[model samples]
Each structure stands twice: as C-alpha cells, then as structure tokens.
Target: MKSSTIRTFTTVHTWTGLLAGFALFIAFYAGAITMFHDPIDTWALPKQELADARVMDKAGAMMADIVAKHPAARESIGVTYAAGHPSHEVAAYWMEKNGTWMTQAIDDAGAHDAEDHEHGLADFVYELHYDLGIPEIGIYLMGIVSVIYGVALLTGVLIHLPNLVRELFALRPGHNLKRLWQDAHNVIGILSLPFHIIFAVTGALLCLTLVALMAFNVAIFDGKLMSAFERMTSALPDTAAMTAAGPGADAKTNVPMLPPAELGAIARKAALGAGATNFDPDYMRYVHYGQPGAAAEVRGTSEKTLGEYGMVALDASTGRIINMQLTGARDANHATYSAIFGLHFGTFGSLSLRWLYFILGLAGAFLFYSGNLLYIETRRKRRNAEQPMKVRAMATATVGVCIGTCLAISVTFIANHLAPYFGAEPTLVVQPVCFITFFAAVAWTFWRRPAKAAVDLLWATAVASVLVGVLDMALHGDRLVRTLAEGRYDVLGVDLVAMAMGVGFGWLAVATRRRAVEGDPCSVWAARSPRVTATTTPAHDG
Candidate 1:
C-alpha cells in the first residue's frame, strides 16, 4: 500500500474504532463472561436443591394443572426437563398478555407452584453485551455500532497489510508509548482477526434481524419479508395456530391431551431416530395440548456437532413423529445457519473451545481498549506544553466508559451475592445499581484528571471483582468444597475466573499509574504539571 492510501485507511480505522470501541468493549467483556452463562446462573442461585427424577416424570401432569389454573398458559407453554441448573429443572414458561415471560418450577412434591426468583446476574450481564440493558433502542444502537466495527476491521487490515507479516510477531516495549501500544494492538488484532470477523458478521446479523426484515419488506421482498421469514424458520413450531385454538378447546371437543412424560419420551425417540445421538431435550413446546391435532416440539442441545440445538416435532395425541430437525439431519442451508449461531454463542464444542472463546473475547475487549489508548497517544501534541482539550476529553471518556463498565459488571456480581440480605427484587435492584455505578464512574472521571480517574476506576474494578469472588467463597465455601469433591465445577469455575479478573485488573491499574508518571510528559494520559524551563543570559554583557 502507498503511504497516502495507508494514511486514508488509518484514518478510517481510527475514527470507526473510536466511534464503536466503547460499545464493543462492553459487548466483548460481558460476552466473555456470558460464554459461561449457565455457570453464572448456578453461581448466583447456588442454594437450589436439585429436584428428583419424579419431578420430571410427572412434568406432564404438573404442566396440565398449571394450564388449568392459569388459562393464559394454554396459548403457549414450554417445559424444561433436564437443565443443568437446579433452579431451571422441570420449569414451565408461558408468555403473558403484556409480552413478558412468566415461569414456574416443579417442586419436589411435583407441584407447579414453586416461586421463580430472578436469575439476574448472568441474564443482566448478557443483556448488557448486546443492548447495554436498554430495552427498545439499545439493540438498534448496538447494531449500528457493529456495522461500524466491521468497517473498522476492514480498514485496519488495509492499513496494516504491507507490514502485516513482517511485524506479526513484533512487540517492542520501549520509551515510545505509542509504538508499544500500536504493536500490542496489532499483534492481538492480527491473531484474533478471524474471531473478530465472525463476531462482526454474527453480531450484525443477530442485532439487525428485525431492521433488516423491515428494510427488505419495504425494498426487496415486496412486503413479503414475514412470509419469507416464516418459510426460512419453518422448522420452528407454528405458535399462531395454537394461540388461535384458545383455552379449553380440547376439553370442549372431547379430545385427550398426551401427558408430558409421554410427549418427552416420543420426542426423545424421534430425535434419536433423526440422527442426533447426543440430544438432551431442554425445552418442549406444546400446541393445542389435548386436542387430536395437538403437536409437541422439543428443542435441545446436541453435543459433538456444530448445530448445537435441534428440534423434534411430534404428534402429541398419538405419539407419532411429525418432523425432525436434528443436528445431522438439517438441510445444508439450515445447517449452515445453525452453525453460525452455535459458533457465535460458543456452543459448538467442548470445555476447551469454550475457554478459547472466553479468552479471545477478553482479548477482543483489550483490543478495543488499546485502540482507544493508541488514539489518545497518536493525537498527543509532542512539542506543545499541554495536550489538546479534545485529546484530554477522549482520554477521560475512554477511561470512564471502559473501566466503569468493568466496575459495574463486578458490582452486579456483588449484588447477586448480597441479594438475600437486601430483601428485595434482585433483578430490579442490580440493574439500577449497575447503571448508577457506571454513570457515577463517568461523572467522577470528569471531576478528576484523566490519569487519576483511570487509576482510581481500575483499582475500584479490581477490588469489586476480587470482592465478588471472596464473597461467593464466604457464602458457599462448604458447598464449593463439596461440589469440587463431587466434580461439579460450575460455581467454582466462575469464582476462580472472577478472582483471575481481579488480578488482571489490579495489574492494569498499577501499569496505568506507572505510565502516567513515567511515560511521555506531553501525552494526555500523563498527569498535567507545569514544566520548569531554565534560561541562561547571553554573555554579551562581558
């Protein structure tokens, strides 16, 4: 690449990264934690005792009773039979009139009246990644950010193409701060290029689905986008017919509904017959439950395949198989689509792959953080007495948003640990607490110098991260020991990861403080101080 072309590409890379880096940082960091979503849920609700097999065996009766009592459940209901988390086992869910999901768990006595407490820790963190916990507009905003991120990735590759191979392994730690940051950024970016590309494409697809549908309807599909979507996702159960059937239709028509246990067994057999050897049904949905036309769809994970979740649809009334969309049985196009989702969500492989994705996600977060630092460093005034106001502002915002996001996430862990003592709805309280902590950190950055703010916020995040792990250990030390002995590592894994994050953040805080004192004096990251310049009078007087 020519110098001029490289500069233009560099400009494109810098601006796009600056525009999207903050949101991407939050997404990547939260996403890293969410890769272990089930474990985090287990960590938050550690005291849940596992229900016996009898609970699952009687799931059909329990679900029927639940629908009988809550007529709205007849519109659509889902049963979870074998969730790894105890709280999630044998749970039933239905959509309310207000479009909210209501859930109930089957107790040890095989009743459906067990209270469903919110599992906010993992869920809230997951929400923060894609939507920043904002309901309506957050997703669209993140969609746009993902588009910009894709652009940044392309332009970055263009700018670095010439020296990419030569400098692939270069990491020069020297007096020049910008060079050090640039080198670090390039190495991580190059190594994780494929991962970054996958995230960009999948993220845009996930977040912009509705927007793209609307656009296609208006532009390309001639108002047939919904029809096209229906065709594309035909494997999923059709809930509209079930909803239109209304409650008690089967009872009025003298049709018998199959019990939940029978439906589950049929679905399992159908899934296996369809070639999913490792299928374990997590969710089952019934349509027209009790009528002769009643159908059941069981969706579950299939291990050792890229298609993580597959569906087996069966006739609930006669135990006849209707259709199977198992992992190995999917059509080429549908299988590719399923593989994309599985890869993006880190559900395609075993523990080793999950850890790889987790580490890469955190490294992706670092890539954005270092990009921001490089931006600040590149724009610093070398000969001027003080840094530009814009550079200083960018520095402050980057420190506030990035570090604050980490702090808020750590605080949420603490909030989850203390939820019982707080005696309130943990979901409602934890979200607000995160928002307050994030905005307060931003506000504090404005009050203090950029360097001091960075150091302080990083330290705070370190403390909170370590504190969450310590608190968890204190609360569930015996349980952790027992689970470890029994080879149940979910909660223990989460705690260990949290403590590792604390150590990582602590090291970053120390390094950032050291840089502020010892790095280039003219840089925005350095603490502002008056430079003393001594002048000697000429010898012209002699």
Candidate 2:
C-alpha cells in the first residue's frame, strides 16, 4: 500500500476501533466466561443432590404434571435432562406472562414448586455479550457494532500489511509508550486474526438475523422470505401435517398429546437414527398440544461433532417421528453454517479447544484495550502540564468502561452469592448492580486523575473478584465440598477461576501503580508532574 493509502486506512482503523472497541471489549470478556457457561450455571444454582439417572427417570412424570397444571407450557416447554458435570436436576421451563422465563426443578420425589427456581450466573454474562443486557435494541446496536468491527479489522490489516511479517512478533516495552502499545495491539490482532474474523462474521449473522429477514422479505424474496429461510435452515416440521393422517384424509379436530416420556423416546430414537449418537435433548417446543394437530420439536447436542446442536420433530399424538435435523447428518451448506456457529460459540472439539478459545477471547479484549490506550497515547500533548481535554476524556472513558465492566461483572458474581441470604432475587438485581457500579466507576474516573482512576478501578476489580470467590465459599461451601467428593468439579472450577482472576487483577493493579509512578512520565498513563515534557521523547508517527 502507498503511504497516503496507509494513512487513510490508519484513520479508518482508528475511528472504527474507537467507535466499537468498548462494546467489543465487553463482549469479548463476557464471552470468555460464557465458554464455561454450564460450569457457571452450576456454580450459581443450589447444589443438585439427585443423580442424573434419578432426574431422568422422574423427568417425564414431573413434566406431565407441570403441563397439566400450566396449560400455557404446552405451547413451549424446555426440559433440561442433563448438563456436563455436577448435573442439574431435571427442570422444566416456560415463559411467564411478563416474558420472564420460569423454571421448575423436579426433585427426588418427582415434585417441584414453580416459584423455587432462580436464574443462572452465566445468563447475565451471555446476555451482556450479545445484547449488553438491553432488550430488542441492544442486539441491533451490537450488530451495527459488529459491522464496524469487521471493517476495522480489514483496515487494520491493510495498514499493517507492509510490516505484518517483519514485525509479527515485535514487542518493545521501552521509553516509547506509544510504540509499545502499538506493537502489542498489532501482535495480538494478527495472532488472533482468524478468531476475530470468525467472531465478526458470526456475530453479525446472529445479531442481524431479524433485520436481514425483513430486508430480504421486501427486497429479494417478495414476501417469501420466511419460506426461504425455513428451507435454508431446515426448520421444524409443518403443524398442518399433524391434522392430516395422509393425503386426502380428513383433518382430525382434536386429540390428546403424548406424554413427555413417550415424545422424548421418539425424538431420541429419531435423532440417533439421523446420526446424532450422544444426543441429549435440552429444549423442546409443542404446538397445538392436546389436539390432533399437535407436534413437538426436541433440540439437543451431540458429542464429538462439529455440529453440536440438532433437532427432531415428532407427532405429539402418536409418538411417531415426523422429521429430524441432526447436525451430524446435515448437508454441505447446513453443515458449513452450523460449523461456523459451533466455532464461534466454541461448542466443537474438547475441553482443550474451549480453553484455547477462552484465552484468545481475553486476548481479544486486551487487543481492544491496548488499541484505546495507543489512541490516547498517540494524541497526548506531552509538553503541556496536562493532556488535551479529548485525550483525557478518552482515557477516562477507556479506564471507566473497560476496568469498570470487569468490576461490574465481579459485582454481579458477588450479588449472585449474596442475594439468597437477603431473600432478594439475584436476576432482578444483577443487571442493576452491574450498571450502577459501572456508571459509578465512570463518574469516579471523571473525578480522579486518569492514572489514579485506572489504578483504583484495577484494585477495586481485584477486590471484587476475590470477594466473589470468598462469598461463594461462605454461601455454598458445603455444596462445593459435596461436589468435589462426588468427583464433579463444576462449582469448584468457577471458584478457583474467580480467585485466579483476583490474583491476576491484583498483580495488574500493582504493576499499573508502579508504572504510573516510575515509567515514562511523558506518557498519558504516567502521573502528571512538573518534570514531564514533550521533548523527553520523539513524537510518535502513525
């Protein structure tokens, strides 16, 4: 690329990254934790004493009773049969009137109280990743962010192309702070380029689905988009077929739906026959229940496959298999699509792959953070007694949003452990607590010097992370011990990871404080002092 072209691409990269970096940071960090979604879910919920066999045996009866009591559930109900380790009890889920999902756990006696369930810890984290916890609009906004992120990635590569290979592993943490940050940013960005690209594309696809559907409906499909999508994705079987016995047969008016146990068996058999061997159904939906036209679709995951989740539909009246969509048996188009989804979510491969994804996710978060730092550093007016207002503003926002988001997430975990003691709903308070802490951190950043604010936030995050593990121990020590005794490490893993994060954050705080006091005084990250001057270091060139 020519020098002028490089400058233009550099400008593009800077603005696009600045615009989308903060949100992407949150998404990446939260997404890192979400890779262990099931473990976090286990950590949040009360200990499950019932064995998987016990839960599975009674699940059918419990679900039948649940549907009998709450007919609304007949429309759609999710049954969680098993989760990786420290297994959750068999549970039934349905959406309440206010749109809150209600879950009822089937106990040892094959009974449950509808009001007893609470949301999982990882749910909020997952929500923050894709939607930032804001409803309808948040997802759309993130979709736009993803598009910008993709453009930024492209421009970033174009700008770095000349030195891409020569400086691939370059890192000089020396007097030139801007160079250090630039090198770090470029290194991580290049190393994780493929992962970032996958995230950008998959995120856009997932979040932009609604908008794309609407656009295609009017622009290309001529109102036939729904049918086209169904054909492409191989959606559930048609409900109309449930009423017809065969071609030219009279439609049945009403018929009772099959019990959960029977439907589960049929779906399981069909899914296995369709090439999904370890098919464990986690979600199901019913249409026209207790009528002749009733049908059920069971969605599940299979082990040792790139296509993790698949579905099977069955006739609810006779427990007969209607249709199957196993990822393992999917065609080239569907398989490729499903593979992208699986890779983005880190659902394929073994535990090792998941760990790799987790590390890369946190690295991606740091890439954005370092990009912000580099932006501020490059723009700093080092000669002045104070940095430019915009540089200061950017610094404050970056510190407040990035560190604050980590602090807020830690607070949510603390809330998760503490909520039950006060008879408070964790789900209701998690988001509020997170937002409050986040905004308070931002406000604090405005009040304090940028360097001081960054250090303070780091320390606060460290403390909160440690406290989360401490509170979990205090609240659920017995359960943790019991799980360990049973050779299940779900809850134990979360607690250990929390403490490890605390240690890591605490180390960062100490390092950051030292750097502020002793490192390049001309840099924005250094504490302001009379000795600092622009002439101390040469101006950074893009």
TM-score attained by model 1: 0.90
Candidate 2, residues 1-542, lDDT tens digits: the string is 67899889999999999999999999999999998998897787764453456666776666567667776666567676554445355677887566767778775676667663544568889999998878769999999999999999999989888888987999987767788898999999999999999999999988998899999899988898876676566545544554454344232333566655556667877777766667776666666555555677777777657878787777777777766778656766568778878978988788888899999989999999999998887887766546788888898899999999999999889987787789987667787888899999999988887788989999999999988788888878898788799888878888888989999999999989998887656556776655645465423321
**Error at 194, model 1, angstroms:** 0.9
Count of residue pairs whose backbone atoms collide, per candidate: 2, 1
lDDT of 1 by residue, 251-342 (tens): 44535567666776677777786667777777887766555466777787777688788877776667777677777678765687787788
- What number of backbone clashes does candidate 1 have, counting pairs of residues 3 or more apart or in separate chains? 2
CA shift at 134, candidate 1, in angstroms? 1.4
Q: After superposing candidate 1 on the true structure, give the runs of residues whose Cα lies further than 4 Å from its correct spot.
A: 57-75, 96-119, 218-224, 234-254, 531-542
